[model samples]
Target: MTGARITVDYDAKALDAALSQAVAALDNPIDLMDAIGAVIEEAIDRRFDTASDASGSAWAASLRARQGERGGKTLTDTGRLRASISRAVSGSDVAVGTNVEYAAIHHFGGEIERPARTQVLAFNDAGRFQSRKDSRARRDGVQPIAIATIGATTITMPARPFLEIDTVAEADIADVVQDFLRKSLNT
Candidate 1:
């Protein structure tokens, strides 16, 4: 007498369904670089606000004052410089910058010169020197600043940084990412 044995196989449909669900879950990943860029942009805008001194920032007051000064169509004009600022994102990378030429100089203190212009500094009676340029030179025993070459007009700039991330702002980045993920998952 011989005995018969029976074997059973399970279907792979359940496994395939689980894998497909996992793949679907991975389809929409949360991206928060855009939110970071937005926060940075807002900070920059706030730094450039043109409100009054007591009610607003000193930078805002100074910038507003500069609007009426000599530097028209210049990067020092808060409105134009603020407008020139832009943020970029690529995958997980992000960057914030300005198109204005003197933005770097403004953010970081530096000296700029007009090489084509000349200035004269003459010694006064008490061994002191008075510096004047072109038509404004003092006519009393005037002495030239340079003997052979023309002096470049120099202006020393103070640093005024408009883009910065503070502790509060830094801590909010994680919240931003989490919120983004939550909304994305909900959708």
Candidate 2:
């Protein structure tokens, strides 16, 4: 959020004058939504492509993505995060967000792990990682993962912002908004 411009306030007199001439501008909620969504989407995409996948935070560059043993994208896989990013447009508002559970932790550096090694077993019914539930981890109907209680293990993931705006992104957002308004008015 270092370079993000959160508020845009227009002079009341100037807004009134423009409103009269561009009455049709921003009339449709979808136009406004699309414009806003595009700005956020493109900004995220740029970060993902940059490999750093972040800005604003000094720690952003420290957490480089690591590849898994099987060449899988692992923790830094932007594919899942990219796919999860979404937008919603309502009559009065526009919203952009990511459904990834770890998105917030990645955006802001944090310490993770319970006081104790909660549950190392795979048979937790409601939690995220169900060992038995995974077909690949099951061997002849037996859980492939061993059930054991490990000691406290903490993990520190640095902030890798996929949803922050830099200076260029701020300008891009303004241009997109302006273009959308102009086109909407002309139509």
Error of 2 at 126 (Å): 35
Give the residue spans of candidate 2 off by over 4 A.
1-21, 53-75, 114-148
Can you write out model 2's per-residue Cα lDDT over 62-140, one digit (the tens) per residue? Answer: 3233324333432344568767777787864767888888789877768898565434335433444556334544643
**Alpha carbon lDDT of each predicted model:** 0.61, 0.64
Q: Which lDDT tens digits does candidate 1 get at residues 76-183? A: 454677788888887667788888877787776689887864345555567676546533444555565543356667888766666665555566776786676556
Error of 2 at 30 (Å): 2.8
Worst 10 residues of 2 by lDDT: 65-74
- TM-score attained by model 2: 0.62
TM-score of 1: 0.54
Per candidate, the number of residue pairs that clash is: 0, 0
lDDT of 2 at 124: 38
Q: What's model 1's lDDT at 138? A: 47
